[model samples]
Target chain A: MAHLAMATGFLLILIGAWGALTNRNLLRMIVAFTIADTGVNLVIIAVGYMRGRTAPIIDGAVSAADAVTRIIDPVPQALVLTAIVIGVGVTALMLAYTYRLFEKKRSLDIRDYTDLKG
Target chain B: MIKRFIALALVVAVGSVFATLLFGYTPDADLNLTARYYAERTAADLGAANIVTAIVVTYRGLDTLGEVTVLFLSASIVGLVLAKGTHAPHRTPVPVGELLTTGTRFLVPLILLLGVYVFVNGHLTPGGGFQGGAIIASGILLLLLADPLKHFSHSLISAIESLAGIFYVMIGLAGLFLAGGFLDNRILPLGTLGNLASAGAIPLIYSLIGLKVGAEFASILAALSETEEL
Candidate 1:
């Protein structure tokens, strides 16, 4: 089931890549990029999940032996969180630049804004 | 049309071959234990349950500091680009909706609270400084969108950012004196595990990161909003 979710996430990333590549609208392209980035983060978090494993928290009643068996891996969760933040930063920066580009060109289409085209 | 078709076919064929090769290969049985070892040691020595937080803010704090510097640099470049050349005269104000303004007025505080919560619980949960900082940045962006007239005090944001940057470096240097390595966690007393006071230097460093990222992002958003400039 987890593998299926991961595969679906990967599929979404591919679809997002396609959307980004084919789309001429700058806003749509940015949205596609965000979708791909989110898909990557989802895949990472899914990889960290283990069947029947509990969250990595220590309980007072749980014995030391039980703790080892029940705790899920938390590294990927941390990594995903980090990746999500980085994605936000990049997305925001991209949007800002896109806005600036739109301001100068008065259009959101990428092909129309090429002043340096030879 | 023929050239485009050939290029598409080549891309599909190469992608399929790579996917097939990846599927055929099995990863090694040995688990990547290095991160785990660092996590466990951090949890024990620093008394933090969220091993990931300890690793990010303590064991690998230098990297986080560098990441913040990169963000700062990016924001500087964006600001420079947005601020270049003479300002355009008599620019028309972009019309904003009342709904967005009213809605964001209520939402901004909640979003800021959640960002703080995420960072505060970082030592015990999945989130840490960077995630929470970015959340705070989004809140600032919301404010910027909702109220373009309400300008952010750039001086205040710059002061906070500069202070945080200096403090981060100072903390790393202090670690050298206390623990013989930059960003060493032994400088502060590691409290009991699962407690708020745990993770010696992790929370401190994370807090600094949060401040730095928040300020940097707010400045970037502000710079981006100015259409009359550049």
Candidate 2:
């Protein structure tokens, strides 16, 4: 299951990167970046997954003393939580830039706004 | 055709590297030293049933603080970018159906309640502030869809955002003075491990985080919605 998730995440990243690189529309590229961010989150979460192990939550089912053996790593979960939020923030920032770009250029195509191109 | 071939080649190259990494990876049979320390000591130290909450709000609290700041910055930049211009394009008022409006009014409170529940139980459950905040923002999005022309009070949203952020910082500082370290969970008495009141300041911090995140996201959404096409 972990391997499958890892593979899926890698595939998503590849597809997203391709779309972002090749797509002409700024909004489409932003969408592609969001997809890539989701893929990165998935990859990070999957890296910590253990077979037949439960979550890191210490409850009745998983005792505190034996949690090291029973529970998956909590570090990755914590890191990924922050990563996901940060990803959303970045995507929003990029979208804001996109809005500004559109307002200035009056066009959504990236090729149309090459004022600084040498 | 050549572009498609090159793209496929690039995908294959990148995919192969990940595949190699995946093949080399092996799940640990036992937790690493740091994870083991957290797992064993979290309940005793913080009295939080969920170790992830302990780690997020206490152990790795600084990183979470930085993450929240990043979100706040992004939302502010978005608001700045979409600020009303000298020549604001007028929007046509579209009437929403009564059924949709009534349904949104009925559902918004329940969604908000669910978001509150999720964050409040951060120390005892899988969900936390980030998830709950997203849920609350989705509820706001629904409201926006139901009544497109209705204005959400920017002042109210900013007030909640800033207040939550200030309270979070104050709580962190209080922990620095009263507890083992910064953002320590021991500032408040830890009730029973599985109880709602348990985990000391975890619930409080999570609630503040939830409110701030929800407000930031809603502000971003409102800014985008207010943008007029040129």
Candidate 3:
């Protein structure tokens, strides 16, 4: 299950990279970048997965005494949570930048912004 | 054509790296040193039922603070860059449909409530500040969708954001003075392992984080939605 999820994540990353690299539209590139972000998060989460362990939360089901053996790695989960939030902020910033660029160039094409600006 | 080929080549190279890592990857049969320590010590040290929350809110709290700062900076830049473009549309927008309008009216408050619940229970549950904040912003998104021209009060949003941020830092400072170090959750008594009020300052800190993050995201959404449709 872990391998399957990790593979899927890697595929998404590749697809996102491909789309971002080839796409001329700024909006599409942003979308592609977000897809890549999601992929990265997925990979990290999958990496933290242990075969038969549950989540890092200690409830009646998993006692703190045995949590070390029964839980998946919590560090990656924490790291990914931060990454996901940062991803949202980044996507918003990208959208804002794209909106400003369109306002300036009156176009969304990458080639349109290629000319040097003062 | 050449650009596409080069892009594909670069992608393939990256893909090979991922593939190699995947193939070489061997899942650890046991928790590593860091994970082991967190598992063993989190409940006793911070009393957070959710070990991930313990790690995020206390063990490595400075990183979370920096993450919040980065988010705040991005939100501010988005608002600043899009400010001039947010004038009301010159034309009337179509009615957003009865179901959406009515549903939003009925659901927005509930959604906001759920967001509060998630963050308030951060120490004992799977959800936390970021998830809760995103949930709240999603409610705001629903509102915008229902009424395209609806304006959120920028001052109110910024006030909530600033107050949450200020109080968050203040709590951290209080921890510094009273507890072991900055952002220590132990400044408040660790009630119990699974109670709502168990994790000392974690619930409070997470609630502040939730409010701050929600306000920032709402501002970003509002700014994006208010832009004149060119």
Question: What does chain B score (TM) in every candidate?
Answer: 0.87, 0.94, 0.97
lDDT of each: 0.73, 0.89, 0.94
* Candidate 2 per-residue lDDT over residues B79-176, each given as its tens digit: 99888743234777678888989999899999999999999999999989998999999999999899776678889999999999999999999999
Roughly what TM-score does model 1 have, to 2 decimal places? 0.82
B1-230 per-residue lDDT for model 3 (tens digits): 99999999999999999999999999989999999999999999999999999999899988999999999999999989998854876858888899999999999999999999999999999999989999999999999999989999999999999999999998999999999999998999999899998988999999999999999999999889888777
lDDT of 3 by residue, A38-90 (tens): 99999999999999999999999899999999999999999999999999999
Q: Please count the clashing residue pairs in each candidate, in the order shown.
A: 0, 0, 0
TM-score of 2: 0.95
Instruction: Please tell me which model should have the higher DockQ, number 1 or number 3.
Output: 3
| Per-residue accuracy of model 1 over A1-118 as CA lDDT, tens digit each | 4566666667667667666767789999999999989878877766666676666555353322354455556567666756776676677678778877887888999889778997
DockQ for model 3? 0.90
Query: Candidate 1 DockQ category?
Result: acceptable
Q: What does candidate 3 score on TM? A: 0.98
Which one wins by TM-score: 1 or 2? 2
CA shift at A38, candidate 1, in angstroms?
A: 2.0
Which residues of candidate 1, in runs, are more than 4 Å off?
A57-68, A103-108, A112-118, B1-31, B85-107
Residue B16 in candidate 1, Cα distance off native in Å: 3.1
lDDT of candidate 2 at residue A62, scale 0 to 100: 96
Winner on DockQ (1 vs 2): 2
